[model samples]
Target: MIGTEFIAQSPETKPFWEAAGAGRFVLPRCRQCNRTHWYPRGICPHCLSTTIDWQDSPGEGEIYSFAINRMGKEPYVVAYVALTEGPIMLTNVIDADPGALSIGTSVKVTFKPAVTQAPVPLFVVR
Candidate 1:
């Protein structure tokens, strides 16, 4: 496993982190624009609306883009996953051969448990 650290959560992103700890993946949605967004902020990036809601995601996505980090002893995949729910998430692609991945590769969400922090959301080849 890669290095893990406890990340601080704010009031706006508390629900998201808590849900992840409970094994659920959620995204922030703007009630005004009817669009989902990532990074789980309080306001919508699209319409700048403070009216937001949380929606459960299917946790399925496709690799939008990726880079293989070979500087370390083990190579890992860092990728942008285009979620099925209309958002692109910056995340890591785990449990797969780095050389086998390509743009548009199908992925499924999986969690990486942290020491003190909530479980992190990651993806694996599907």
Candidate 2:
């Protein structure tokens, strides 16, 4: 396990952390553009609209890219998962062999306790 460092939560990202604690994955969507985005911003990246809402994700996605960190204290896989909702998120891929990870591999979200009270979302092979 990596060092449990608390991530500073902001108002815009509070919903995401809340949902993760409840074992659900969520992302911000732009009402105007009907597009989901990562990194929860108050304004939509697509249409630059302030009308954004939180939506539940299917918690499934495909690995868009990945890197195996062999030099770290503990070997782990870091990846960008392309959510079915159209947003790609940078997250850790866990519970699988790092040697076998590949682009387009199916994965699902799994929440694990973090150093802070809130849980963090990680991905596992489906």
Candidate 3:
């Protein structure tokens, strides 16, 4: 119940949340382009191919970029994770000690409920 501010989980992203609830990092992998992408799509953004599959990832990544919010309504760490399979996921980095996280730091995926509906992928320092 850390930040249950009533986030509406979209139907398009429901599968991703469902996977996270099962402790899996599911993403859309385009078979034609051989690349993975976040915000799952029906067609490959790279090649415009409709051959897509849901694959489980290792959930290991690095902090490609980050910001330490100190003055926001509720301070938090927002980061872009460069996943091993070449997908960049925009997520919140949790359980980080203040001033401890930085760009390029290694991170791992963790799950927390998305407003009690389903688990969502969150990141933390490895």
The candidate maximizing TM-score is 1
Q: Judged by lDDT, which candidate is best?
A: 1
Candidate 3 runs further than 4 Å off: 1-12, 72-74
Mark the regions of model 1 whose C-alpha exceeds 4 Å error after superposition. Answer: 1-8
Candidate 3 residue lDDT tens string, 14-112: 666677778888888888978888767677888999888889888899989877777867678877788888888777888887488878899988877
Tally clashing residue pairs in candidate 1: 0
Compute each candidate's TM-score over C-alphas.
0.92, 0.91, 0.84
lDDT agreement of model 3 with the native: 0.76
User: Judged by lDDT against the true structure, how good is candidate 2?
Assistant: 0.83
Candidate 3 residue 74 C-alpha distance from true site, Å? 5.7
- What is candidate 2's CA lDDT for residue 46? 93
Cα deviation of 97 in candidate 2 (Å)?
Answer: 0.6
Candidate 3, residue 117: Cα displacement in angstroms equals 2.4
Local accuracy of candidate 2 as per-residue lDDT tens digits, 10-85: 8888887888788887889999989898878799999899999999987899999988888978799878888898
How far does residue 65 in candidate 1 sit from its true spot (Å)?
0.5
**Model 2, stretches more than 4 Å misplaced?**
1-7
- What RMSD does each model have against the real structure? 2.3, 2.4, 3.3
Q: What is the lDDT of residue 12 in candidate 3?
A: 52
